[model samples]
Target chain A: MSDAASVQAVRATVGDSEFDRDTAPTRRAPGVYDIDLSAGWTILGAVNGGYLLAVLGRALADALPHGDPFTISAHYLTASKPGPAVVRTDVVRTGRTLSTGQASLFQYDDEGHEVERIRVLASYGDLDTLPDDVRTAAEPPAFPPMEHCFGPEDGPAPAAGTSAIADRLMLKLDPSTLGWALGAPSGKGEMRSWFGLADGRDADPFSLLLAVDALPPTAFEIGLSGWVPTVELTVHVRCRPAPGPLRVSITTRNLAGGFLEEDAEVWDSADRLVAQSRQLARVRLG
Target chain B: MSDAASVQAVRATVGDSEFDRDTAPTRRAPGVYDIDLSAGWTILGAVNGGYLLAVLGRALADALPHGDPFTISAHYLTASKPGPAVVRTDVVRTGRTLSTGQASLFQYDDEGHEVERIRVLASYGDLDTLPDDVRTAAEPPAFPPMEHCFGPEDGPAPAAGTSAIADRLMLKLDPSTLGWALGAPSGKGEMRSWFGLADGRDADPFSLLLAVDALPPTAFEIGLSGWVPTVELTVHVRCRPAPGPLRVSITTRNLAGGFLEEDAEVWDSADRLVAQSRQLARVRLG
Candidate 1:
């Protein structure tokens, strides 16, 4: 079993449903393995454009269904990488619970090509309601939950061991919505927290994209400064969040000079927007 | 000279270009256009994902530049429509100065079948500066200078006529060494800023993408809340910003339950990281 003991026995039977092992990251053409860029779930030191958009959304939720709810409506970042990077996905169509996909990532020098390319389309609705031409029914946006939020300290740390589904659904956060705070300022230099997954957990979609790729910096509750890390992140999942205290709102629309862009919506506590994310950062001035 | 009299004689010789010729919303293909989602530009009306990402970045700067300093790097949005939406673009390579293209927009439902699909990948670089090793040496983020920021009033009531390259590039707002407050938020959902041109104006890449697609909400400037207009927007330039105040950032990552995604990043104040954009929004809940 050596590929590092089958990558440590497939990272110790990850999120076991009796060990599924696909670790999905496919892509037969267009450069190859567009998703390694130094592996997933890092924080301050960087790596967490939602952990490579939940590893291109766990390869589009391993081809859909188990009560499909996915969300991450759109994303883009054609190119930008000085060091490491990789990502790969492709489904195009799986149908039934709903499927359609495409992902390509690559970055490792001499102008490492294809920075990102996507075309996701997934469906499998449930929390129902809200489609009559959706013109603001208002309601969502209350806040304060998740044991009052507080997580994320500094850079590449999470590689310990967790999985009874990443310890019953990863990336917790709810010290009151991880202490809500983040108007914007996080070009990748780092910080992340608007996280999700707690109570009776059900996260799924790669554990709700590893709980928003392991939160810690909603720019540290809005103090702001400099640092850009998300070289690229794209999410589109439409539903999935049985976990708990997930209210996330964070925003940073644009950041000139250094180059930045941020967006998050994630809601489930009856606010319902469910999934949406976008990122591409590269600012870091210490 | 009839086309609303050449758009009213180019808005009487660009007296503060804010030109608005929109009314033409209804082409399903062949150059394509259809985002009218019922004219909701200001109060975040329902379909304006930054005006369909400035009409797919003015159909990719009318398929590659010529005069202006074309900018825009990222954008994402997969679908959205209240009345109907669609766009189409493709050039991929033009090259006189530099050009490359791709634009795919499809939003239908009058029994047309497909509901949403947008794809974009545009590049037109080559003004020089061919070094790269992922630059951005540092120093940016100051916050305060959108000629004295204030917006949130949700502008839009003025505009008698404009667009001589947006009456010569007017949008403003700068300062984000990572402090976060970018610009173009005079209220009304997702809008953005940091524009150029003006002084002796002479733009082309579709008038610098209609002046950053007429700077305005792509979505989420701190919960201004849903609209999800743009169905597609993709850009990538990297150089050219001769004018001034070229520092912009925009965000609105995902919205799921209502369908959404947004992006923008343009820098040049020495902070480098020139252009990037992504869009694909479908939310409608006004």
Candidate 2:
């Protein structure tokens, strides 16, 4: 089948999927998953870290005694490729409120050697059981209303990059953030955008794995370009997102010794803080 | 021997050791070591997250094919207790620039069952090999000179917090940030302190594990505080810290539905940014 035919068939049969079915896993045992990779997930010869984490997180969430991820941290040891690998999880603790576990992704080599790639520790708890809402400080970023925002229908494809991850996630970047991408670099290191799946699926804990890191590197907006690899990323789920457009913002307070910090917070249409993330990344000279 | 006799014997022989000497291992085996927990490191009968992480980090740093930890993240699953446990490390990838690995701390129950209590992912690289510094942004936090600042030597011990970990570490909080501890709560959720080992050891990658999370939970300085346990913590070692004092500050921007985020930055006496950390913790109303 041609590329167009495959795309049409996917649209007709499966209305929405963050990743291809080939990358899906088979759970032959407890806390273990046998997963096959798909080339479609690769951005530029390497699988997107956020996407990889979402899939890995799904495996852990499904295997754990509890289901929802309250806090998760993933370290990208290497670029996971399109091949066979296994995800393993170890139970750390199971409490009345929160359960903690460690998940790892492993790929077998030619001599039947298992090489670990990505590892994470996540705390799981029911979103419904959150302590009664009592917010004393901090407010969500102010974003333009939906009518004024720019979606894919209102603009051209992202011409500055050819990333598959970008194609899968539709972004309505704040006009102020777009100037830097067009070569009129903004010295400020920050990114603000409205985000949702391209196919229009409501996000769950898994998709949030990708959403938290969806914004372009804040450094790109600060005159530094090229690939800014994230050394470590940590996300905390404050609450399950309410359906509709998710507002996202990322800011860098310090760019020192060739490294920068990216701090992000995600809010739902209901104006509830859904997730918060922080990452440490090295800036490449472009 | 009387309690005083044993204390005198220990002071004469062991000098400064939080963990037991019997738990120390030879260099032949990387990542496999029997560890004994010390009650002295416990805060309210449970091991302090920062102190436990420091021990775990030492094992990983010593066992790694390379011996430097530039970035490390730890998730507290169970409150580690006084008992026997083991530290295990898995090589994720050994690269030219950065090497990554995962370390797990396991504690056994009375029935001989092993349970994972803490897990971390650490990236290692030689401090001397970092690219020539080109940080045009992010100046260090402005602070007063040492002579003008206060030290714990000039103040009273923390009130009624029977934590030996407290005795092991000394903190000199900024006067502006000390209102909360005295019952005159500072409505602000922030903490800034000058830190050094009570035993006088210069800060290193291991001590930094303790240093980054050493600040009192950001919630305490705010109006809420009974016990705010950290669910997850991440630290980035930007550069080798210079000799002398260390400045640490933690601030929480949002307090929503009983959860708050703490962002921390650490600067060495040389005014170089040595490390940065962030943690998510549940708020306890005092």
Candidate 3:
């Protein structure tokens, strides 16, 4: 491709949207922000839950002076859309070691009335001050080295289709688990991958949110497909990730009464468990 | 002990305070209730996280038309005290399968001002309609039968002491993980126990909340002691548990700078994964 064509292709890959939400500010209000969600931060129909949390995190970081969010649990009341939305923050408590706050993202209806969409409860603290306890029983459940995982750069064009959010994130999944993307699921109820931010912004709490739910719905690997909408999601940041790629492992152990549960654990390249999260989702079938 | 004394002991074991919480309503108001959280609910000068969640669950159930909560993620912004506190709930959404709401528990100070202590986001869901999908890849980690595990009922009586929450709940732990109570702390970073509502109330969503955080902090098994207050907790109820005991497995995968992570999995008597939860806590040291 020519230099000019290559530049155009790069823009197309990023979908003219954004991955580093830290840079997506459009209009700033006193305690609210009209942030640009861009068009590419989604999968299928709804916006990606993690990417949404990152947006909330950026707005939250500005609202609280303690530090960036070290813990954020987001409840997806409804599916959010791309484009400009309002982020309104409210400080709940300011403790000696931690600060608690809540942020809501909404967009105005055609009638100019605000419609609330996502709600997040965030806790901010000094990540650098965390203890150096090296004793833990968890390591990102073992996976093959990154060289073997098939990602967008080294693999064939996506067979299940890719969206704007896909461009900003690099999730090179273990081949065996990506069978479902080709309409052939391994039937094991697991999704494993090597994940990271596309622009090397260095993994932080914001990316941790998206990374937690970034794995394709584990249901897709267990014979259930289509949009799997999450009703609720909670992410626990164990530590500020040691700047590097994250190992992702998400598995669904139960699919009862049309509802399923996904448990995710993220480990940074340093072999430390940086973040872990779980979500309750409903399986939408044909 | 005489038969009369034994009967009194049994009643004491069940404690006047509740673990199931369905029958523990003491005071009431419109979309609000003053629940009895007895002083016995604390570990070391602070209320247990699960008990706090149950208080929120009661208020949420009354606020929404839905039957109960299957998805309740609680954030412990402050250390709540036990007493006749008020539970105030606000409805966020009313969907067909679920209803979303937030509840805050408050107690008046000597000056008579309502002070908010804990905040909960509850997603009310009907347990009856859940699909009975038993096919799961996760199971209660292997453990000896209840008869083999130790409890306050058997072995050496609890040394760290018991609370009202403890009176209503029986935790016969897998012997391997209970070494810490004796001050030995096998140092395995694991705490496994066979848990249940001692009064035979049948395990429901509220009780499940108590059960998830019921396990003695896994950090105890790793040589860390004292208060260890939970900063945040998120619980996912997979399905209605069978009418019997629950097996709980809580393990800590990381403990850094004054903070630790606890992952809990609860399985019912039928060997079904009934609920799962994770939390971020501060390690209170001597």
Highest-scoring model, DockQ: 3
Runs in model 1 deviating more than 4 A are A1-11, A14-208, A217-286, B1-19, B22-52, B56-104, B107-286
* TM-score, A chain, model 1: 0.29
Q: Is candidate 1 or candidate 2 better by TM-score?
A: 2
Real interface contacts reproduced by model 1, as a fraction: 0.08
Could you give candidate 1's per-residue lDDT for residues B1-286 as a string of tens digits?
6787576455222224332234233455565655544443432333334444455656555545632223333333344454555666655335464354545556767777864444444444444533343423234334466766433222442222322223334455432221124333333233445565434343323333434445544444434433435433444444454434565566553444455555555666566555555554455555
Docking class of 1: incorrect
- DockQ values of all predictions: 0.04, 0.47, 0.65
Q: Write the per-residue lDDT of candidate 2 for residues A144-216, one digit (tens) a residue.
A: 7656656444655343356656666668888777666567767788788898876666766666777878777
The RMSD (Cα, Å) of candidate 2 is 4.8
Instruction: Show where candidate 3 strays beyond 4 Å.
Output: A1-17, A21-28, A153-161, B1-29, B160-162
True lDDT of residue B30, candidate 2: 57
The A-chain TM-scores of all the candidates are 0.29, 0.87, 0.88
Q: Which pairs clash in model 3? A: A40-A164, A40-A165, A50-A210, A130-B257, A131-B256, A131-B257, A256-B131, A257-B130, A257-B131, B40-B164
Give the lDDT of residue A264 in candidate 2. 86
How does candidate 1 score on lDDT? Answer: 0.44
i-RMS values of the candidates, in order?
10.8, 2.1, 1.7
